[model samples]
Target chain A: MNVHEPERRLVTLSDVARAAGVGESTVSRVLRNQGSFSKRTQDRVAEAVARLGYVPNRLAGMLAGSGSTAGAKLVGIIIPSLTNIVFPDLLRGANAALDHDGFQSVIGVSDYDPEREEALIGALLSWRPAGLIVTGLEHTAGAVARLRASGIRIVEMIDTDGDGLDIVVGFSNRGVGCDSARHLLARGYRRIGYVGHDITRDLRAAKRLAGFRETLREAGHPLAETEIAPGPSSAAAGRAALGRLLARRPDLHAVYFSNDDMALGGYFHCLAEGVAVPGRLALFGFNALDIAAAMPQPLTTIRTPRLEIGAVAVERLAADGPAETVDLGYELIAGATA
Target chain B: MNVHEPERRLVTLSDVARAAGVGESTVSRVLRNQGSFSKRTQDRVAEAVARLGYVPNRLAGMLAGSGSTAGAKLVGIIIPSLTNIVFPDLLRGANAALDHDGFQSVIGVSDYDPEREEALIGALLSWRPAGLIVTGLEHTAGAVARLRASGIRIVEMIDTDGDGLDIVVGFSNRGVGCDSARHLLARGYRRIGYVGHDITRDLRAAKRLAGFRETLREAGHPLAETEIAPGPSSAAAGRAALGRLLARRPDLHAVYFSNDDMALGGYFHCLAEGVAVPGRLALFGFNALDIAAAMPQPLTTIRTPRLEIGAVAVERLAADGPAETVDLGYELIAGATA
Candidate 1:
């Protein structure tokens, strides 16, 4: 029961070799599952490893400096928040791709804090990961300097609005906003309102809002009302925001939410409040999340290439190509809500 | 632009020391921000590091055998799936806890595959993480052996149905099922049915189902019907499964779903099909997710302490105590649905 001793002696590769009655190199080969080793010798080494409890220090192997294992088979990934389904979706894609290529991910959640992101970047960098994938282009000057000087393959994902430190794989957030506004406009819904979570922390949302307002202004129909929830996006916040927005601007014909989570809340609000979606009040959202489609009346939203961005970021990192931006693009889902 | 040179020379601590006109020890001390070092020396080392792109290898530092950095400030966390918000919420809790303790997490997704879990365990083990956190108590023999032999702390989370390898932190899934069934029975709903996703992969769900069935049989009601979707739990799958369950046995007075995601789907189905919930058919679910509370008719479900389980697991790992099971009990939310 007392498993947590202060300092238990670690089992070494030499211990495995000694137990197996084989050379240290043979034990190493069997443990790495690399180099030439006979089946009998492999079985012996495995038995010794299990018996001796030899957990190989892969860091030592990397320090030994074989060409293939020169860099640790690890990728450092920093995302804004895990609460939003979007980041998880991105991580799922990146993890799958990295796993396929025999790499593991060390993850840090920044919680939309620039200073935290910088600290996470430095912590992750100390591990000497093969590559680093960060969420956005916006970073503190300290973070940017550290990333630029790290000399590892760096990938900035989920937004393609500005210059990137290295490889950038994502669609334009502003474009998604502009397209969403156009879709709502095409549906002949004017006097549009906006309901969203905190945009200050979510720079992408801020960009989208800018583009949306710009498009609406050009059309001579500016946003009628805006309700910005104080914290991270949630269905409850979305519902309450929609309620508050509706109470303030009852004449608004349509509502554009920051993302699908907020929009789902808006839809639920409509359902609970006896407001006919699209008939009484049109609703539009971003990120065509699965739940968005599963709703009784599907939510009209912009489907960003979240998974593709993560996957392609890893792919580009592994490919080790030139520093360039790859715009995977986005799609507009014209569901019943709009 | 051509960052992908085949053999880019790596900057070393020695190079930083040479550039800064300081000893390698001073550079190391400055990089770690540990030990006694002058502010001027720290500035010099930082300037040199920035100039030479020197990424201090923390692994190498650990190998050098400093007690403070003896074991890497890393914890390996392996979860089943990322698509399910439950896992993210758990990860968020664990990550927050780990981050607070100055540890980063290396994550792997087993995708509910035992073989994959074994592989991921082996992979994570090579990193020599300070501790390991895996989703369930049920693991392959290989994984169990490796975990037992690893000698470091291991925390198995989110289910307490069976014995764990080390520290176990979670509520009993079977107990959740029993309580849910009892709640429905108390609400005067007989002719009950069950709808779930592939329980063959999700062992916890299988345990819950077994408990639900046993409790129902004890009450002399028994399960009226059952419908299981072929893949992972999803809103779409849940909605379709509920629809199919209803079509097969319209006389069923109540239904229990795998979790809140499925329950939400069923709720949406009721909304779409105009099935009067708790009037004609009562719906019960597990895992009182935030969305479950946000629903118009709040879902009747068990609120498992997911965040608490994760945080407690990390706390137990850090505490380095005796191997023990910590049962953070679940709460039965008596909502409007059941």
Candidate 2:
């Protein structure tokens, strides 16, 4: 109903053939390199395709069993948050690798909702992508079933906590949490608290909190006070969460945040309130985002292999192998804050 | 050729009709609300569709003579970068709006390459999305021709200097640049410098630089110095650009950066090198990003209406009418930097 007019048809193989002054069969053979074609014909067809900007419909060709199609090269990548630098960084790596490998990415944002993720997965699957790279292992049962039945390569990213449908590419979120707790404990911070968005909804953060509490229990410190804000983690949310935590327990030695956004917010709060950094309260966070190091006082945090994970995910998809996990571990940046 | 095995077919209208205990014609009539159908038939058919997850292929239906289907609900959103926080934030807003209206976004990243952008445009149009939302007004002639021929809702986003194919939704990059220059001049910074990435590739940045120079020339204070970095703007790149600018003209009173990323890097450079911000050298940038306000000193920069542009683009697509240009406008946040 919204159509203004009929679209001009796409430049097809026949058009390329006509433009190149060659038979359609010759053009197909040249494009596919299936049956032998002369060098002159190949050059002519290539030139014609360039002039026409003829991008073959790979999806349609894949379905039609055309010789010229290299099957499905489109990789469907679904992530949680685009505003969160982590997801974009992840896409950067995937895109770089995919571009080099002649693969295109069809991106879908789930907005941290598994039901949305499931719907997106179904839509992406309908397009018949070569691979589906989704954020985290957690998914609705329907999503899991669709993924398992799709036959396409599956790559679950960011959090490596559950069994993947096919391949998994990321470090252990739980380990990152436990390690943060240990780092704080080593710094002689007993009254360490937690500042993050709602963990139950964000399962990865939930895993981190569980690991953090587990380690704190071992150290007999326990979680001094916790502020779990109910929504997306942001610098503002982080600042507010920190404010709430401090109001309840002003003497908490330090706080472990869900991610760098919250940590940055907390850092801003300290700057705003003139709180002595480590002298009064130490701060630690996950995802050593670009801003972390550039800050006046660098944020002490864990840098996950976000880009590497994305790159490896695409690389694995290109390799076309059996199900396996590539544990690109996280790094600990011990800045002055902690 | 790379198929692991055969796949199941998409849910057909025939299947829905059979499941609903009606003929295919009745089902189509009920679904499209064309020929009259009993209320009972409509309910049964709708229930069957819901139970079957029958997403009618919009492109196919459009070709097959259906005024319904909205033709397509998938909006193809093309941007220059995924890592640039600005683009992501724009996408966040677009996605929210699109999702609210029961539409999905198919995102394509061109990484600031016009040729890539052209290719991506072709690929996106092949899918027959309801609308095409692209980053800038700049495009290769071939790309412009393709977009004009595509016959979908074409929205040129971010920059609004050139004539759009259909609807234009963004602020003027030149205006942003001129405003920043005027803002800096009012602060009495005569020996003004610029730290930026290669503007030739980022046409929007080029317009800003041109406008900045134009304003400076009118004021009889030609740009004192400039250091254009080679690639994408980053804090690291910003620091280096500032370093280069300072090495040549140490007495430069102020430096305007391409965007906030470079500005933040310059800010960090001053923080690390013990140079007093605004006292030793005033700093200014475009795109008042999130970290800008939350920083130790809020960044003095322009905040383009990124999210609003995205939201409005989709809204325009949904509304479907005559071509229009929306000047969402920009804001100059007079922070302590200048």
Candidate 3:
């Protein structure tokens, strides 16, 4: 088997110019319709471009005009993972907002690695995007430095716990944790446990845990047990972690999961094990995903304004405004689970 | 509030050269670490670049060098939607492979609109990506024309039902539907229903349904009912659609969902409504998602090689092999639900 070479050579602007019997500058002017050109010249250029199949390089066009930094209609978005539905929801909102404003997104997944985030930031900045949207407030020093030096609008999303470099659009993760603890406590579940995934990489999850613990401690009922599953957060991991946590502390009356995915897993475990939800053991979660509500016993969770956050981030990037935090806030759902 | 202007002007290569007391070409050579340059000149250029906060214009560099096509380390990926976990899984695999080879991805979402797909194709091609990966074989005539004329490697993913412009890497959607129908038939289900999302936009689902219907007809037991939700597939939509379908055709023995998300919703519906799954009614779905297995009674579904398709597409794009179709087959997971 031989490697497939490019089927045909790319038709250059020069080719269009030659075919149209006009200078390259005239061809460019006619195509861009920026400078004064006759109707006949424009027609000739268009016909030549169509016939030659010349796709104008926007990158070069932007550079030749006002530089990519000023004219490139691109946004760079870096997220932790796509496996979790939360990130996709965020992208959906961002993409819709961007599409409306005629901008395209160049995306990078950091995989919860600081080094990777730094590398991705450098790679993305090379495109000279109009703005950069990164997940959370936490980033490597190198990554932060690049964002600051890029001289473009920077929007840090999904967390507002720390100071942002420029624009910050998200609710506080710690606040979600606190609200969850308060909800569980209000329901009179004292012996509460925690089930989560890797918090080191998912810093927001860590913040949530810290807030939950603090809220629980303040309520004079500290966490009874904690089971943190290794690796990324998933339904299987949540299910397995819940089983282990229950095995360790059978007396635990409630469990606060890191998010809906893990909480759904816990819910599944309860159904399989015949543990009566909100009777034998209560459950609370974060991010009220669509599935969370559709379950037999709807999950008692915090519904972060995921889509709104994404949309607002884009709006802020486009709007001429001072850099400020836009906390869309979160809603605590009193579902049957708790 | 005043709009946030660019905090500072971008430091150009001219600034670096001026600071380094050298020509712009000398500064470029030193920074790229290409061509001959004196050690002292390199040191001076590096110092000036650091002092001036100069970020290199990779777009300009690529255009000036071998043009963006041969030199740009970018791959344009246009997926249908981010809301569906299936697309993200595909992207996750594709991104991992691309990252390993030092390639970045510029992504656009078509939202299952043919016109939008055509527009995105035009936009992506303007970047002059080394290769382009678009979802599915079905595209508008304009989109197909653009892909054929682009001259770069093109990868059509997720469905192998039609002819491709260049490389095709996916399993047959019709086969998946056929196999699923057979699975239900072998399980002794006669009066089977299909709960799905909009088949018009989701052509893959349409293919699956057509294949299922054809297979069932050949076996002398045609489908009993079909409930198609109006919007994109989601757990909520699935659950709602299942309710509507069962309400209309309570005599149905088994139900096939378009994908796991919809099936999961159907599962939830059963749990909520006390419908005895696989006892009074059996359930089958496609895409063996993580949550599918963790459910109380695991969902009997087909596990499409989503990740492998994405990874293989990238590998083929990078590989020096003749353009060909790769059939990465799927698996049928016979879980407790069916």
DockQ score of each predicted structure, in the order shown: 0.63, 0.35, 0.58
Residues B125-173 of candidate 3 have per-residue lDDT tens digits of 9988878999999999989889878767899999999888789999999
Each candidate: chain B TM-score: 0.93, 0.89, 0.91
RMSD of each: 2.5, 3.7, 2.9
- Give me the TM-scores for chain A across all models, comma-separated: 0.94, 0.93, 0.91
lDDT of 2 by residue, B257-283 (tens): 999999999998897788999899999
Off by over 4 Å in 2: A1-26, A39-59, A66-70, B1-72, B100-102, B148-153, B247-250, B317-320
Query: A1-338 in candidate 2: lDDT tens per residue?
Result: 22555545567778998999999889877876888988898899999988886766443455555222366767899998787888999999998898898777778888788998999997777666778899999999989877876667899988788788788999999999999999999999999999999777788999999999999999899998889888888887888778888999999999999999899888878877888897899999899888778766789999898889999999998887878888899999998899
Candidate 1's DockQ is 0.63
Worst 10 residues of 1 chain B by lDDT: B62-71
Per-structure clash totals for the candidates? 0, 0, 6
In model 3, which runs have C-alpha deviations exceeding 4 angstroms? Answer: A1-9, A13-51, A67-70, B1-9, B12-52, B67-70
Decoy 1 TM-score against native: 0.94
Local error of candidate 3 at residue B59 (angstroms): 0.9
Instruction: TM-score for candidate 3, please give it.
Output: 0.93
Q: Output the number of the TM-score-best candidate.
A: 1
Lowest-scoring 10 consecutive residues by lDDT in candidate 3 chain B? B1-10
